[model samples]
Target: MMNDRNVVPERRFSADDSISVVETATGKRVDRRDFLRLTGMGAGALAAPALLSGGRSVAEAAEVSGTVPNLLRNGTYPVGLWVAPPPGETTVARYAEIADAGFTFVTGIDGCGGFCPPGETATAENAALLDAAAANDLDAIVYDHRISNIQNHPSEQWRDVIESILGEYQDFPAFAGFDIRDEPNASAFAQIGGINDILGQLDPGVLGYVNLFPTYASADMLGTPTYQEHLARYVSEARPDFISFDHYMLVGARPTIREDYFYNWVLVRNQALQAGLPSWVFILACEHYGYRLPTDEELLWQVNVSLAYGCKGIQYFTYWTPPLPGFHEALVTVDGQLTPLYYAAKRINNNYLQPVGKQLLPLTSESVAHFGEAQPSMGVEVFSGDEWVDSASGSAAILSRFHDPKRPNQRWLLVANREFESTANTTLTLHHTISAMFEFDTSERRYVPLEKAEPTGPATLAVHLEPGEAKLYRLHANQGD
Candidate 1:
């Protein structure tokens, strides 16, 4: 049962046939090919790939070295914000507020610069931004809006601009990437690819940032027949180190969320899985236009949902509380006061996201399935091999299966409560006997053994989760069962 406090009125979700999900019962389908794909092609054969960067596969390289790695420490995943430039002068005081909010990187609002001086003036401006970021324990994804205008020009001119910006800021340890463009269509892929080529030649370590349009865009807007096709073309042409995009649909006075919300994730998850690329998604942190302030659950919905789909990082649409009107609901206010959303974000990020993210980064996503009322139409795997498993019926949950390439026998499960405004009691039932299983404790920040259970008939692991909360489990197999 849901706590009615913030329960959004029951609404029908959009049906996207391209990404499949099926009801719990198997009777309707004759052959469950898609269902099997959604689960696993039978466990041991599953191979989870590493995130690719600069055309190099992290899984392969990291495994060969035989050392554990973290996304933050390794500088792979960036949980961050879209910040406006400093006010008037080049001061990083805002960065302290950004750092205080627990964001790792600060990306500009537009290409080159946003709310800052133009041209060579930006060179000096970004220097201050990066300096402040590093001093305050944050990273800077330098945005050079200047490059956008001149990328179409001759190589010499473009090179001069790209080099000028990179030259001024590349040495800063806080420098993460150059925000090359935002919400680009297929027409810009070739151009983006050309710019990325220059970036590679200059500094392969830096990410060439170009955020894509969400699935809701029209074919004309995307410059491709379908949204997936748009992503495919960009991946093929741009050779980006990673992919990012934003879609703000949690709207209306009653807080109506668009069905395309989850659909957009499917597109990103499918593509990222195939490309072995990391993915970043943005959530609406501020109120503007028709969209109002998001409840804590709404914020968790985007962040946790992204994690379920294997998103490596998350970003807030605005962290600095832009000077625009009606945008007061963000983490920080225009006057730098903390809003309730800020504290909510802090708890989710520090207490939940940071711990889980650090733990899940090294493990590659093998498969994902959903349960409860809003389940993905494909199907969730409650049973595998001779073992039959069942989750609490009617509890909306997202179950993600992951595997460490180095430890193939070991497996992981990340269960997320999908209902944005309700608490879910999920009982995971396994019909077949197992040696042992454990749950990851985010609070203590370690795995604690779950009391061993024998299958008198079925073994059950029950968990209670707050709205938009998640839990991770580890299953251990005993030999010669």
Candidate 2:
């Protein structure tokens, strides 16, 4: 466990509102302005969160002693990676990289296929995977042992397979659950749901994992009148514990981005919320099948947009590089070298996703609003320009509203930059007085105070958001001074 006192010393603001940051090596005081500029705070506004433990923020680290003390213990949010570990490399370091990046869970197999070395029994493979996961206090989603497409397979056979896998590996402390299938159509739900129920009966904690197809799936392939209908049928038949889906909306194709990209999120999010189930969505980690490689801003946009919709979990499509053609440049290369994305992923997860995801797990998303004409899901209302002091900054952005039962009557706002190519400087003039405002310190995994708005006639909060960056503000008029 990290000791808070040793990390972030309290900030002492200078007369000019320039805060002091102590340099770790020499104990020299660095001006906050210069520190932010150097860290590209204005460029991305990532500095809003006190980069705490394991990432960048000393002050945030000082505050939240153990954001997650036991790695996978306290967290209810499930952050999973579709691992593509290099063939023949099952070292502790390999798995440790996943854990160190703040992912709480790992899928035992790779993308586009199951475990390689087809002769390897899923049971043995899962146990070995568990060994790696356990070493880092992470969990593994048991994948196919020998059976393939068990979800589409006959229900009785699927049960037998699920039972066999669980019987042999369910005892492992690191076993998270079994991956039944990926992107199942509506017709397969009844059988898969039965298998899910059986898997649950075998061990209640083990999830019946089945990721759904996104709205991008053709209407005919969906087998339902609409994508929404497709999901409705799944929930009714499959009886899943939670909902999950994958949409690679960042394809820089004809539209430059998927037209239904934002729509997919809203649809799945609403469906999951209505069913009273938490949902998980995947962000693209590799370029393939016409999807271009993502820049850092694009990556952040994917995550922030998901978070804005109140997703309970964030799943990366690929962690290790896939050996398949066209699917290249994963966080780790097929040859076992680290890719640049590996480090960037490390920063985003530890610095933002994991911490914020954990914090929002229990809260429910009440509503989502998009600012400007470019974003927001289809049919959703866009924020009017009159609502803010200046609309130019947030002309294209995401505004998510949430309700936390733990703090009755309290609401939270998550503001995100819509575009991935530049920064957004938004001056928000609240229609009402906000009690307090704070930025979630990803490093500390706790809420740190934001300076109070100047006492102008209208309470205005000047926000500087980097491309795809998000600012979380807590509203509590009752606690206002």
Candidate 3:
């Protein structure tokens, strides 16, 4: 059984409070000061130190390259929100507002930590929400509390309860999947897997969605020795349709990013590739407890970094802020007003995520190379140079290479600025083998010729990336021509 304390609850912590409390993940009691120190929210930890960079040592490249595959099972590039509009605010207009903000889907509609009224029947509300979503060209994941916890019930009642809960919603065109659970322990894998099996058997078209805990979770919370092991067991035992996890690393008053942020991505990206499954990540959107409100660059940083690491989908945590005490300033206010963060997310989704995500959907991740002063550890490969590219000089950046399965000679490179608070001025030197090059135009949703590049032979292209921005380039290699 999953630990009850592991489930996400409304956190209640103040910066100045020194009272002893139980750390949520470890289940160990500690004073408030210790919790702050462990979470990187202590007084002296104002600036984020580069923990991933050290001695320059190149590791052997892996023999196998992982393909992301076409995992857009819902037929749209997913830009989802965790908390949809509250129950009483469920309207076609409300969903239209969500669509206007460039969100493609909404999850946790019925039960997102007391967002819904007490004693509300989620099945009935979900039906109405689905209708609204379909009208606005959006998808929804059903999150009825009873059905989500189906494993806790008797074995025989699983089918009846599942069918009774999900049977009607399946026919709705906007119905994407069922919200199984969030942040489950390894001990609960068998039960979760059984539920997923039945879900697949009954309806193959719909997905079984479950989000895991981030690398920050303690062994006690994960019920495993390490976060990688936790993910491996989840994939093997749960038999999920896709992998999803939430990592709220951008925290503290001064907004220092956690050290293991990229390390977590390395693990998730590798695991997803190995499983041949698409992966999704939850971007932090709300301010609560130790986490501060995300700035525009910070938000874009999260999305672009996830994309660079080959995540297939994006969901914002708490789109509509929960009514809990510590929670505040989500994309939408609790009273239905839009916030500045909402517009920032809108710009990101429309300008970058949707277009780039669609372009990368059918491509395979060949490798990711880190370039600049600070290189992430945990076996992340450094960019020494490649056959088609001589070097990438100036500014820290992440370069992710992808190739089309049918056309091996064609390649795509996504170069993202590593700095969230500063711009990167980069110069990429292409080798003689690259016959043609182009940049993806987000406005046109197509590739346009690189204005500064030569038609053939070695070429140099200047890349200017804003804070947390990434540019997609398409390359054609000469094949013994």
Candidate 4:
């Protein structure tokens, strides 16, 4: 537990200071020590909430200590590497490198085919892998385990195979969790439910994972509305440990790629948020059949955008370039060297994101407000413009973008250009007295100041955005101040 007095020696930001705490009311009397722990304070920061201690309110205890609630405070999540085995190297070497890469977690199994290593040796192999991860103080998650395509195997057989693997190695310290299948269509959700049932029968302690499409497809098919409904069935009815999804960027998709993706992320994730589930995203680092591999900048965008939308963990597509070449696109080069994307992970994890994680482990929130139509159309509604401005208050504010009261500092705004590749003129006015505005670049993982408007009381700001690009704003101000 954190001590409030020790957490906050003094206020860091103030009215007299250049940066004031902008959103909501000030001096809310937060517990400092708890804040430090929740906000991922300095190394000397207090410890995290003790979980499973006889059903105590871990969040409340941390809050009483002085920590703020879990929100986007700071820090790149501690980065994890998806270990790839070289052409001839045994699984042991792969495990060693995964630990060496500073990744505490490994996803999927070692072999290339659709089956986990067979027979009695499978348990021994799993134990060895667990030993390697533990020795390096790393955590390992076995996802897309060697179950053949559901198209090939019956759901019952799939359940049996998954059950055996879980039963054999449920006690291993290195086992992080299990993702039942890679990508399943709507029809496969039932199989996923069956797998979950089997896993529970074996070891209820381990987490069950499944991947959904990038955007929620309609239940009519696999799109958002329907997918959300189906997902709810599993969550409420099946009650799995955690929910995971595959978020991929097609080759040559859009102008503001990151922005486009972020909105999609928000739409789909908002559903998971409503379900109150911890979410993880599977990012595409490798090139699909004919698609191109993601560049370093694009890779950073995937991680940052997902994190901004509040994904607690990330899953990478391929770590090793397969010996067969044509189908192999990996974060590492063919020779098995770390690609630029690897460094991007290191930088965010070791520095910016890690510090923030120390403070608030971002859990999904139900405080989202949807604007306009869903994706493939205008990603976000153009809220700030000549028509939307308030002439009397001389302020520009979009009521549609306002947040639900449930979230503390739970505010987010989506702004974008009307025309693709065309710069447009727009002004954003704040209904409330404007104190501070910040925009985060998902691709770059940096924040920039939107030049403050010239007029004082009325916040009139000019926005020049390219097509397909959108800005997510974090606004701060006291209510009725």
State which candidate has the highest lDDT.
3
Give stretches of model 3 more than 4 Å off.
1-71, 109-122, 253-255, 375-379, 451-457
> Alpha-carbon error at 291 in model 3, in Å?
1.4
lDDT of 3 by residue, 99-127 (tens): 98889888843422212233334354566
Error in Å for residue 336 of model 3: 1.7
Query: Model 4, range 315-391, lDDT digits (tens) per residue?
Result: 67666553332334576665667777666556645544444333224433323222222243324333323222332
What's the CA RMSD for each of the models?
13.8, 17.4, 12.5, 17.6
Each candidate structure's TM-score, on Cα atoms with residue i matched to residue i, is 0.78, 0.77, 0.82, 0.58
Best first by lDDT, ranked: 3, 2, 1, 4
Query: Which TM-score value belongs to model 1?
Result: 0.78
Off by over 4 Å in 2: 1-76, 110-122, 145-164, 253-255, 374-377, 384-394, 456-458, 478-481
Give the alpha carbon lDDT tens digit for every residue of 273-363 in model 1.
7997878888888775446688898888778888887888899976656543334457777666778888888888877887888777777
Scored by TM-score, the top model is 3
Please give the TM-score that candidate 2 achieves against the real structure.
0.77
Runs in model 1 lying further than 4 Å from the true structure: 1-77, 88-93, 109-121, 156-161, 253-255, 325-328, 374-394, 431-433, 453-458, 479-481
Give the lDDT of residue 166 in candidate 3: 55
Q: 404, model 1: CA deviation in Å?
A: 1.1
How well is each residue in 287-395 modelled by candidate 2, as lDDT tens digits? Answer: 6545667777788888999999888888887787654444557777867787888888888888888677777776889777787655355656576643222233444
Against the unseen true structure, what C-alpha lDDT does each candidate score? Answer: 0.63, 0.64, 0.72, 0.46
Which stretches in model 4 have alpha-carbon errors above 4 Å?
1-83, 86-102, 110-121, 143-171, 194-205, 215-238, 252-267, 353-360, 363-476, 479-481
Minimal lDDT window, size 10, model 3:
57-66
Error of 4 at 281 (Å): 1.9
What would you estimate as the lDDT of candidate 3? 0.72
